[model samples]
Target: MTVEVGSPAPDFTLKNQDGQEISLGDFKGQKAVLLVFYPFAFSGICTGELCSVRDDLSSFQNDDVQVLAISCDPVESIRAWARQEGYEFPLLSDFWPHGAVGESYGVFSSDLGFSFRGTFLIDKDGIVQFLERNGPGDARDQQGWRDALQDLAA
Candidate 1:
């Protein structure tokens, strides 16, 4: 039940690793958002995918876009993970409502008590421009995201 393309991106206010509140709607009319929903903070596949985003952050954070990674991990764990990985992007904590944000996006798994690997590229207008979800233990290729961003610019 991942949110479909052309749908309005849901709005949410969640604490980042730094305990700062961030909302999706804050970016509207400013920058497109890359909302990444992952199961955990320090897991293997999750780390790899986010690191790739970290490695190419400029491409994602120029005048038009920004990346925000969300997970069910507590803010403390997220803080440690972000500090360890040198991730400058916001790593939001969905632990208060226990994955409610991911659930709304159709990525949370009640059975597993976590979220699948779901990525949504939302445009400045709050419309979902691209969407992809992978089951547990699966990896994601980030090029598709870049291609979609290119299309958005075109």
Candidate 2:
């Protein structure tokens, strides 16, 4: 089952593109987390969606908010993609366990060997405040995310 809003988010530790360990709990009591799970690093829809986030990074990442994008791709692939796209935010790799974190969030597709587009907004208290999932090929509207962040701020 998918993780629901109002439930405690499942904490995880994964390597970022730089190979640095990043844990969900590290942001606890500091900033709200926008956890984004994408299917692949260089795929078209994923790139577009993340490019939008990169373009409006300040809105998604700031003192009170942090965006962490995860994919089942290897850290090397994600590192190249981040470098090529000039993304300032962390692009995490869930490749070692092959979508373990995605599975925990109920977004992983075992048959497809990747995750669908799943976005979760987790507050500093570790409670999920907003959740949205889109199937493969379905583009997400980031306005909803902005609205959720605004609500959290309020």
Candidate 3:
């Protein structure tokens, strides 16, 4: 099921690097959510993209918005990666079900055993306001995310 703009986002609870259970509905009525799905942890492209977000965290994560990065890697791997990279935001592990959340968002590659790069911005009301999908090895331009957040604010 491909999640589309203006539709309700699929809700799921996953464990972050710190072993915290975070649910999509947790941000409802408080903050918009930016769900970032990536293939693996500690990879070069994924590191570059996520480090960009980490560097400009205030833009993606503030009172109005929360950024959640998800991957199929095990919790221990993500925990180590987050610590190694000094990532302040949550790095969620979608490992137990092995990409269930990614599959729900239509970004999981079953044959590849991982998720492609996918981004979804869901509003406080649980509606998806923006969506973008990129295949493996394709890097996403975060400017589009900032632009969408600007529109969401306006």
Query: lDDT tens digits, residues 1-154, model 1?
Result: 5589999988999999999999999999999998989889889989998888889898776778889999999999999999999999999999978989999999999888998989999999999999998997889888888898899889
Error of 2 at 112 (Å): 0.7
Each candidate's number of clashing pairs is: 0, 0, 0
Q: Give the CA lDDT, 0 to 100, for residue 45 in model 3.
A: 97
| Model 3 worst lDDT run, 10 consecutive residues | 1-10
Tens digit of per-residue lDDT, candidate 2, span 44-140? 9999999999999998999999999999999999999999999999999999799999999999999999999999999999999999999989999
Clashes of 3: 0
Itemize residue pairs with steric clashes in candidate 1.
none
Each model's lDDT: 0.91, 0.96, 0.96
TM-score of each: 0.96, 0.98, 0.99
Candidate numbers, best TM-score first, in rank order: 3, 2, 1
